[model samples]
Target: MPGEITRFVLKISLILAVFGASAPVLAEDMLVIAHRGASGERPEHTLAAYELAIDQGADYVEPDLVVTKDLVLVARHENELSDTTDVGSREEFADRRRSKTIDGRLVSGWFAEDFTLAELRTLRAKERLPGIRPANTRYDGLYQVPTFAEIVQLVRAKEAETGRTIGLYPELKHPTFLLQDAGIDSVDLLVTALREAGLDGADAAVFVQCFEVGPLRRLDRLVDVKLVQLVNTNDGPADEPAMRYGDMVSPSGLAEIADYADAVGVNMNLLFGPEGIPSGLASDAQEAGLAVHAWTLRKENAYLPPVLRRGTAENGTGDVLGMVTILEAQGIDGVFTDDPGLVVSALAQ
Candidate 1:
């Protein structure tokens, strides 16, 4: 009788410990999206970024895809090559350098549209913000610009090894600009590549994101996989002059989006309300039952919510704990951040 009692006590103790450990993680649904794959710790969109994010316990690693002239999909923030590479320094390809408008803004850089995938492969990927993060300069020309295919390979390996679903979230960057102007559309090409990698449709654990309504909606029509709509401070497409963010934040707009999309990816500033803090929800967003995923979080000062800024310094002072807490309270489904490890650790703590 005594031994049985002791064993029962130990079993009870173990159950209590597990419940305690799981309590914090169960408080809310917190999806850690490696914003451009742990970008705060590595050069964004490289294999190093994706690997580190997975290693750090990110639920999803986001890769933004743009097409090259040869129709190969490559991971990039935009079609432009200036900020993320040493392309500007190579005068041999100077003629390839030209200015173009993307989403109504005239950007001066070497666009991916100007280069074949083979030609782009010759250039190495580098830290996008060398000015703010000169330390990243040490790795300026080491890694290749990874393709969407490579990221799928990494995720496939993890899923096979662990039997846990590690997902890939690829944003179709500048879809309207790429489709109409560059003559390359992501709907067909990306879906096909994902299918090749065995990550197509809902069963594949791949979620596609896009800022323009038409592209994400178009993708929805093409595939059964989940679609995420990205909203920003920028203006809507020329055809949709009637719809803008100031108005989109209205109840009517969010509901319309909820009809087509599984989730809404909003700028952190707007969702959290510019205070460097997360506001619970805009009445409109909550009513729509649209899952909210906030974006572009970094450990940098420039991206920090205003409420968290302490000094006169222009950059981040590494104060992210309060913001995470606020996000938890706001009931966010997922967050896009350059430091997924930091976010995961904060939630765990």
Candidate 2:
């Protein structure tokens, strides 16, 4: 979404020069944003998970926002109803299973937009990454996806109860495509919800992120809260047939985005590039005046780096140290990990 002009000199900064010694000290103060609440400890997007995240010391608890059929705001990864729920097992709604191109993929499943908020709450949350969270399944059917309003209510109440400011980070998932297909996009609704809850303002502790730039731009035109443009070079918008996300990460691409958004949430791989670990994007990202936040950090070996794998001295039995390593080395403003406890522990150490 850069304008017609683009420029890049690759003037990477030298923050990493003293990083070796600074790693321990920096880890103590790094901002930790819970990926989907304390997902490492509870079902994601459920109020329980988010509440635990705050109790565990998350600077912000994230919720991916979506709208239901009744126009109420709910939380879910994709509007998809299959992977995260028992929607497929319900014979009554079995006919609801179908396919549609969401953000350009022929995805077929029961989608969130197809249900009302009331209906959604009747369903329970499942481990989206069961391979990494088999233990989490013990609590399966224990929690339900919560509404943005519910989260706002909880966070405000927590701020009062704990005397600590806890922020909310929301990603306006697939906004443009939602409008193009489902006739339901939640940015306006989300902004309105924030205002109604007294959480929308320059001083509001909120950060909104999205992979697509169009919605962020549109949201900027609507409200004055912080916004982030998420990037994924591997399978992002650019890779989509009719998508242009690939163009969004380039120097010119990012500069254009910096115009409308407050920061960028690039995939961890992009921060480390194809090389992985020991490397960070502090210099390049800093040049853009954009704060970098990486996502989906977890303790599972699948999500952990080889050197920082489970049970290693460098990373312990969890994913925090390895990730915090990258966070410090790269001078990242924050990160989204399932284990806010681990993140908080790492920060304290």
Which candidate leads in lDDT? 1
Q: How much lDDT does candidate 1 score?
A: 0.75
* Candidate 2 clashes between residue pairs 3 or more apart in a chain or in different chains: 79-112, 237-245, 238-245, 238-246
True-structure lDDT of candidate 2: 0.74
Candidate 1 wrongly placed segments (more than 4 Å): 1-27, 161-163, 237-239, 274-283, 310-316
- Pairs with backbone N, CA or C atoms under 3 Å apart (clashes), candidate 1: 275-307, 276-305, 276-306, 301-315, 301-316
Write one digit per residue (lDDT tens) for candidate 2, span 162-236. Answer: 999999999877777777777886778888888887777879889999877667877888888899988775666
Residue-pair clash count for candidate 2? 4
- Misplaced by over 4 Å in model 2 are 1-28, 235-246, 274-280, 311-319
